[model samples]
Target chain A: MPKIKYIEENGKEHVVEVPVGWSVMEGAVKNLIPGIDADCGGACACATCHVYVDPAWNAKMPPMGDMEETMLDFAQDREATSRLSCQLKVTEAMDGLVVRMPKSQH
Target chain B: MSEQIVIIGAGQAAVQAVTTLKAEGFAGSIIMVGDEAYPPYQRPPLSKAYLLGKLERERLFLKADSFYPEAHCQMLLGVSARAIDRKAMTVLLSDGSRKPYDKLLIATGTRVRQIQVPGAELPGVHYLRSIADVDRLSPEIVAGKKLAVVGGGYIGLEVAAVAQKRGLEVTVFEALDRLMARAVSPQLSAFYEQAHRAEGVQFCFKTGVEAFEGHGKVERLRAGGKLYPADLVLVGIGAIPNVELAKEAGLTCQDGIVVDRFCTSVSDPAIFAAGDCTRHHGHNGEEIRLECVQNAIDQAKHAALAMLGKPTPYREVPWFWSDQYDLKLQIAGLSRPGDQLVVRGDPATRKFAVFHLREGKVACVEAVNAAPEYIVGRKLIADGTPIAAARLADTAIPMKNIV
Candidate 1:
């Protein structure tokens, strides 16, 4: 199992054990996290699953693709470390990564 | 040094573009001008859950009140941008204020196409688009009165579903041969016709509404050489893009404001357009305009990238979804006029996916009450992979492996 930590806007952190193949968005949604709506259900069509990865773990994750990059641009309060959680497929190297959710999802 | 970006509409496209700009690290002054008083909100739910009083008004908001400040964008509501001075790079609002911008985005979107019948302006007739329209119509749905819905598109059908669920006598009048003639295949349309009919929704297909008969409020609809009585009428023929501002500003306008794949105005590099208001060159070299929320958000991002001088081409597959009753219809890719459709799953069970093939290539997929198929179908459409008809029609095989 791959462990992931999600920090909400108020600086509250949640640690969840996710399957290796599941995307970060899927992990949060399956665990019933407060954020990560995933309205389009991991289709990368909607930006509701937007999150900002910790800069320290940025290099550990895969680079954003065209589709993910395009969807991230529509996310609210996007930052230089912004990534669509649905696009981030979990791997062993990505364990213990931290992501921050925005205050609101448009 | 920072530049100013002014958007001419406060619709979905405008809101998405503002967010996209800030996300891309564009430190610029952003201003959104719109005729509506409120910020951009979801329009799809207005005719469904919102109309049935199942969803709250706050949940329908696209963003919170603090979103603008957090994103560092300014909104000018209840004021329309009357004209654009291209030479001076300024937008003139109706209030006689001129705002200069280094880059201008046209996301004015579209307005409901009004009926040309005699009693179109009648008191009881309405069009569903803005929150104001939904607020006025919700009480009627709750009153459990008779209703007549003109046009059989997603809007009309979704509203009819909600009205019927609310225990109203609902009758739908479609001028075309089938429901959603332009958007869905005949099989899918037939499935919906049967499903709605089963839900006590009366259908009057191939009927042209000639006039609305009433003294001050609508009482009857004259169509198909017959008069049908109604307590309220909803006219949802379609929508036409709000391109008057762009056209008046001397930008090239056809069916909509013409833009390239980059969402940049074909005639001007400084001006870009997106959303339902702009018709961009499609993959097949035809001018195409999409009205769904996906297009609004995606095209806005493309336009933002263009404004940033990134020049990212917009080539994502167009997808749309509609919810009616208990069925959720998701469609991916664009289908041509005469594409061959293959049906998978049983319409009798009210759960199936229809695949449209053009010249042995998958053109589109429409799934009704089928979630897994819609997810897999979208990926296949995006990949443009060819799948055998027999394989697609076989329900035993999971769709994920087909691609």
Candidate 2:
């Protein structure tokens, strides 16, 4: 399992050990963290799982797919560091990864 | 004593409501009653990836078993809500329990609209709305087995796609002239039909299912005076909201449990409704009853907020998606019959989007394997952004610059 840091929009922080094969969205959701909605359940069909990846850990993340990019545009307050958490699957390299929630999800 | 909140349904809406209540620091006891045996599970994947056996069964559950107790929510599974006693503010359950509630949330969702004809209750005849439904239906998707999918709607098309991929001989029998006639435009219907056909799925449009003619188990389907060989039959007609409890409790019922902007029942302030069971006002004063994950989750959030004494209006643009073969059709907002259709990309490329505009404003967009369009289209629909049709249709111009 890989440890991930999730930061809520209200400045609350939660650190959980996500299964390696699980998605970043699932990591937060399964831990009962109240940020990522993942309304589509990692299908990338909805943009409610938008999160701003930590600037330092951007290079370690999975490249955004066209579908993820498209859905990201639908997310509120999207930024350069923004990414759909569902697209980022947990791996050994993603340990200690930090992501911040948007003001609100779709 | 703290407030007693009872939620009559254990699906997406119930789980979301419980989550929101705990998150918002609501100090109360939450009780969830569901007819299903398992905890609150998602229905979207039941007809798609789960049906294909690609996704794990545990993934279907929205939350873990320990979550409810930690949130002070008691989930009463495998029990039916027999009645809602408004006078006593209590609910009678199938388990011979009467639980009193200060506030009640009706998230009973919907039941599969069964195909009414002879042999409908046959063992092999099935409807896909629950985890058990798919569990029983999954083993029937054997190679070389003939499958008759009724309705040609989202569930039907998704299942047909999965069955075809698993080597099942799939045939879709639609009562309408075109596939998904009620949901999508004619162009989209043609595109999806062509896609399914290319993948070896047969289509019988304008064919009404007269009956399921079989003995002990489903063997064949008779549609439009013709009998088709069907080793297993899937009825994907539609769903009917479970509103009898609300109606019996003296709540307004018009196609769905009628609720206000805050998801509170029109006649009872203490009773709120969400998900597919409730009809809420959507865009343009149009009352809509949506059966999708987006509506379930968003409306549940609204209902939970209102339960916490914060009534916020839910005005989310209704969005839905269906996966068939390689095409992922994503739709945002509602489109009318006379809305202008604009093509954003060439259909020949197998990746394109159709825009439905009302008075030159972006009303709805149906994107097939075109996420950029669907994503940006939702924003346009929500903002009511007036469009430049020429720029929108130009492949060179990005979606962000169109408005």
- The per-candidate count of clashes, in order, stands at 0, 0
Alpha carbon lDDT at A19, candidate 1: 75
Query: Tens-digit lDDT track for model 1 on B186-237?
Result: 8988999999999999998889999999988999989988999989999899
What's model 1's lDDT at B55?
Answer: 59
Error of model 1, residue B167, in angstroms = 0.8
TM-score of chain A of 2: 0.96
Give chain B TM-scores in order. Answer: 0.97, 0.98
Task: Work out the TM-score per prediction.
Answer: 0.83, 0.95
| Tens-digit lDDT string for candidate 2 (B170-191) | 9999999998888999999999
Q: Which candidate ranks first by TM-score, i.e. highest?
A: 2
Q: Which 10-residue span in candidate 2 chain B carries the lowest summed lDDT? A: B394-403
Residue clash pairs of candidate 1:
none
